[model samples]
Target: MNLTTKVNVTEEAEKLEKVLFSQKFWIDLGTTSLRIVLILIFAVLAVKIGKVIIRRLFRLKLKGPIRKSERRENTLLKLLENTISYVVYFSAILAVLTEFDIDVKGLLAGAGVLGLAVGFGAQSLVKDVITGFFILFEDQFSVGDYVKIGIAEGYVEEIGLRTTKIKSFTGEIYILPNGSIIQVVNYSLENSLAIVDVSIPFDVEVNRTEKLIEYYLTIVSQDKADFINKPKLIGAHDFTETEMIVRIIAETKPMRHYDCARLIGIGLKDYLEKEGITIPYPNLVTKSLTDV
Candidate 1:
């Protein structure tokens, strides 16, 4: 055959193959749908059976190092479940295409290009997912943990693959991308310190106010079970024009900072009032026109 005739024949064959792949009928739908159904059944069976058997073995309480190891295993199980589901669904798609007798060779070559585009677009997204996985596996934080991560401080509400949900003290929900978290301050990991400031009028008897605070600090330290660390009456934090700022600080358990601060404030108030110590208020002194 002449070169021109051979080129024409190859073009026609390519066009025909395109047309065949694009043609979809009701019969094709039925076949593909059946395959999807079967694959879905297999995925469900795998999850149910795998969880029952694998998780059952972990049912008994583990102790010491074993308990910590078990938690890491749980993280792996969650990752496995996610990976397995996607794999099963992908296998179903390939099977469905094969049923139509479509050429998978060219599809694979096309897939490489498509996958390259997708991979580049999803780099940060994948990083978020991978970092989130490590966060969980390492037990960095858990739901209900009060943490400060990347300037967003709050209690962790939920932990997902790509993001973590934190409810801030201002009642705002912060959805933090895992990849963006550089510093993770897991306050839940250790005891928290509560710091409270109470300024009194400078003209008031400083000795009396100091004594009252000292008395109440003792009472608070002894009464509150949450007070793991004793309260410190930090004497005079600052001397302002209007008042002397007296700060009282206490260290308590993970979630007890708020309550600890409140208790100190209340106890100090009642004691100081009984002792006739004045809590400072902003003063508006008006200079008379005569003085001017």
Candidate 2:
């Protein structure tokens, strides 16, 4: 027999056996009725079992350690678990009602209409889903990626079916609906530029300065761990009556460009001083009337 029939039969047989036992048969019958009343209890137990399974699976996901935004994946999974439990519990109630010969056809139709009405009232909800789909497929940004959307710039905190969460550098959490995300600048996707502008004084011999810089740059570039590209002393960028400006450029690895730049700055000054090169300082000249 099925679970329902077996349960009923067991309770019935237990009651009959107890009733035939002694003078307290009526009390025993009442206790047996309470035992059969635990049908809902079993359904609740099943829900608990499902939750345990969900927890175990989620813990395994944590161990796998896939990078995602906002630590929100855990919350989303919990919400799904709750939804499943409620849905299954409602289905069980409907099954029990069917056993009592209740017609739920009208109720189902009413629920459908109500659902449609609610859906229409929440247009943003629909927009959220549509936009979220496009965002993921278009690869707008992934978890742990530094990005800027509109006025907000930070590491992507989370990407959900409805909204995106951003954690700002200033420690503010910004929640943006995917539908509202019009412009996204993802900084983590490509290489970064670390440009250093080195200024030389007018009195310093320009050729000596340039050659020394180029020589040092070649050496720096030859140092495998320190350099990225062979440093190029580009054409003179600016010429003023007092001093000239030269721009040095190098292509370096992402995020480490700053490291290369810092090294260049510190090393450049020391190298120039050791070569007896002078850094120009601002000098103002005044003419006296008598001298003129």
Candidate of highest TM-score: 1
Model 1 vs. true fold: TM = 0.55
Q: Which stretches of candidate 2 lie over 4 Å from their true place?
A: 1-115, 221-228, 280-292
Best by lDDT: 1
TM-score of each: 0.55, 0.55
RMSD of each: 11.4, 13.6
Cα lDDT of model 2 by residue, 174-201, tens digit: 8999989888877665555545567787
lDDT tens per residue, model 1, 1-292: 9999999999999988876676565567777778768876886787677666655655553433456544456766676667666776677667657767888878989999998998799999989988998898788888888788877888999999899999999999999999988788776766767777888887888887787777778877886788886788778877878888877777777677777777777667767777877584322122111222
